[model samples]
Target: MTRDANRPLRICMISYRSNPHCGGQGVYVRNLARALTDLGHHVEVVAGPPDPLLDSAAKLTMLDCLDLYNAENPFRTPTVRELKNPINLLEWLSISTMGYPEPETFGYRAYSHLKNRVHEFDIIHDNQSLSYGLWALSRLVPTVATIHHPITRDRQIAVRSVRSFWKKVKHLRWYSFIGMQKRVVRRLPKFITVSEFSKTDIHAEFDVPAERFHVVPNGINTELFYPLPHIEREPNRLIVTNSADQPLKGLYYLLQAVHAISKQREIRLTVIGTPKEGGGIEKLVKKLDLGHIIDFTGRVSNEEFREHYAKASIAVVPSVYEGFGLPVGEAMASGIPVISTTGGALPEVAGDAAMMVPPENPEALAEAICELLDNPEKAKELGEAGYKRVQEQFTWKNAAEQTVAAYREAIRDHRKI
Candidate 1:
């Protein structure tokens, strides 16, 4: 069959610093773009430095920016050549002053590139890069942003988690970009969030009305997370994919629970991530004396992720609050029983298939882990149920279709205005 050039809608997805390793935002972008293309739409991603990986069918336009926070050499001072450009200087100055400038700078860079080719795209989809540049683009084109969750939630968690005034101040500085995001969210005609919890949080935190928001839960990449049943599961092992460096992830609580569980029974924990050297989590593991039984695999490839799931008896997501718990969906898809807290959108994603406990409760977590460990039959039932639920409800194809609906709605709303 011959391809029809005019059949597919041209899309421009803007993301300001998508690090695939750091979090789900990058995963969301990569998987969503590929799924959208699979639906016959032409997606062209305009991403900032450290670009997102996309499907071969989708084109990626790497928008150059000062990648000061590049994980390899985070907080590195800009070179003399980098300072010659005003935008680069602005980015460097902001970072030097303990501020985040990527969203604003990336938005400016996107606008600079898109202004000349604005007509080429059917609509612009901003991936939470709330900057003045994106606001400018909204004026000229139909624009909608996907704010996964309000950043204010993260900041609130961080501030409350720490006692040190200086550390709180540092947390505030790193997340100072919320100012830009909130301002931009207030002005944008339409934006989407991944869950009802996030929609309510964004409205309360940013004072954006519920009317401007759309709820589209993220999808799990089933292909990467499905079961490898040939690999034997460990009988007394627990696995959790944690944001090891952040308190909001509740890794400390999980660690405490694991310590308690280990004392009663010889159980091991496999953490599918590495904690930063000298970070709070690393210190806590030592403090709790959990080094021997706990294993932090740092970052792992997709094959490794599935392999880890295959070897684990159960999966846990101990986040205090999640915009949407990708780990829960991924674990479910991997045919692993999940034990998650009733935090944020975890319940929304986990539904009734997995065991639930309260957030920030080590006692509740240990009870759940122990109960499942003691009953192999119950664990297997939960695992099969979780896998069935994910197969029926969550997949990238579904997310892309729902997202496209929002995009078209945004376009229609823009023309009406």
Candidate 2:
């Protein structure tokens, strides 16, 4: 199977669910696949949809599933005809019982798809679908997985966020897939993650050997996030990308900060995401009576992102934890002065270009926001600095080169085994 080092490597990048608009997973898949292809590698993305929206250079293979979590009709019971396939039946039954089964089911689907064609690629790069089927795939090909961060942290935070016993039980049941991830990841020979913090934490939680992990920071998509000079920056206007109800995103604290600041001055906060109807965040905004000052821009397109940044005086990331903090990098790339909390790997992404606050502290977020608003010169300077940092250090080209090194290492190790 040895090939010339100068030749392009055939890479199959797999993801169970990939929607670029949803979360970091889709974003990661899209950017990484494009970058790798740009590096003269033959790249293909094997994904379960809502489309990944990949660049035309990279090939895309759509893997179908029941898609029970589709937003239009979430958790809908699948038709009996759809469940005729054993895999589809397993997926429906698992979700019906309050268990998340996408990762495991997708792994099975991927294995079934690729088992007969193992020689089509030099390596299989899994985007955290750490499932039993992945282990089986590893035996057939050189497989490496990227564990963005341990979902164990998610489970811990979710369990702690709820008060009722049954509610907590439901959360535990939903996150039961994490147990499968833990079992599968440890068996893989090589792993990739975004930050040292993530690598350390995942090793501690998943008990994977530290040497097995490779740390590669995510790249900013500058094409979508660069500053718009033609657009005027509005004063006392702030923006944040919100996962409104998730305790992990810390939008609740940001709402409080906005409420406190509004008492003394004219301030407006534009959230680049929608809150769930009558969700905790929506309720919090109503309770604080901050609707006048806060505007949630539901479902922003990629083209509209920079304009939102251009109009904002400052951007804030109030995350309780992050594996890499893509929003911080996006803000930095957009040349917006940023105030970010010292959450997991946020400081790593932000470096010294942002104002750092203690996570989950509304008062600190308020103070930092106010500081930037009161001093336009300082805010502008920080924005320029952040833009410079991203340009010099966070290009997808750099990430792609590092990732190829890890891929080669995995290939060599696989051959030896």
Candidate 3:
């Protein structure tokens, strides 16, 4: 497919799991597709498993795969109908017995379906499904994959933190997909990442040249995330958005900080994602007698999420690492003062607009939260500055423009080959 400077480009975005509630990948797929469509391009998102909440402007093609690990029921037995397909049954058996991530296997299913209609799109953009199938598809189309960040970091952190030696072994076994991802990522023609921090990490981890990577910042939907005029902000209330049960999110640290803060001052915590009813976080909440002070609103809709941001006096992002902390940008866009840890690309995204602390330091987190809570004027000033920062720096329009340029560059480079 040749890029014509005057004509609109047809683009297909592929993702293995695009559940908005799952994590950043779904959010990225939805917002980027909308932004590309807004730019007068034809955008089709082909995804698997959980449904993606996409913009109406973009066309959505559902490519269902055996979603063996849905969050609602992490590991449930497939029905007879789901097991009727021999490939699906084999994939399920492999995952059940060996503990390997299935996104690549599923991506193969999606690729096979899309490859038959390869001529339908000018470019194929993948959302972190760095599978062998993607390499196969790249030969037939101008393909570019977005590697959010190196999954190796996630595996290392998870393994090192496991309390039991057996559990650590299991962690390594589960994350064995990293081997496949590393090979797939290195062989890709071009890569798009959300931040320079991630780009550097990707190059180091996958041994890809710096020239093969493009840094395109992810966007926040300011329209949906903006502050609510009617909602009253709560005093001394703190909010953090994460898959709270996930250790990599650093929710445990935030919980420790909240416990420390509650001892000195009256504070309330509202967690956006759900925690296991009898999990570590729930145990901590009980141990600290934080039932009255802490509340978890599990898997809220977009409007409700915005209301939580609006009601909170401040937002805290306690991630151990992020490719680009979407919550930080989302909080900033919602006109909320942010207190983030200096983990990964957070400082790059927050800049001077947010108060930064070191990750896993409950004391530092408590101090920062206290400082903001004690001084309303400072908090309000920080909130306004953050809003302006997001407005100027991280918008979907900017991301799409940079991405389109990268696509054009990839096409030019491919032609020379």
Overall lDDT per candidate, in order of appearance? 0.88, 0.91, 0.86
Model 3, 119-217: lDDT tens digits are 998888989888888888988888899999998889878887779999888888888888888888878899899999999988898899999999999
By TM-score, is 2 or 3 better?
2
lDDT of 3 at 236: 91
What lDDT tens digits, residue by residue, belong to model 2 across residues 274-327? Answer: 899989998998999988888888888777877899999999999999999999
TM-score of 1: 0.96
Clashing residue pairs found in predicted model 2: none
Residue 90, model 2: lDDT of 95
Clashing pairs in 1: 274-298
Model 1, position 369: C-alpha lDDT score? 94
lDDT digits (tens) for residues 134-215 of candidate 1? 9998999999899988888889999999999998999899899888888888889988889998888888989998998889
TM-score of each: 0.96, 0.97, 0.95
Residue 94 lDDT (model 2): 89
TM-score (C-alpha) between model 3 and the true structure: 0.95
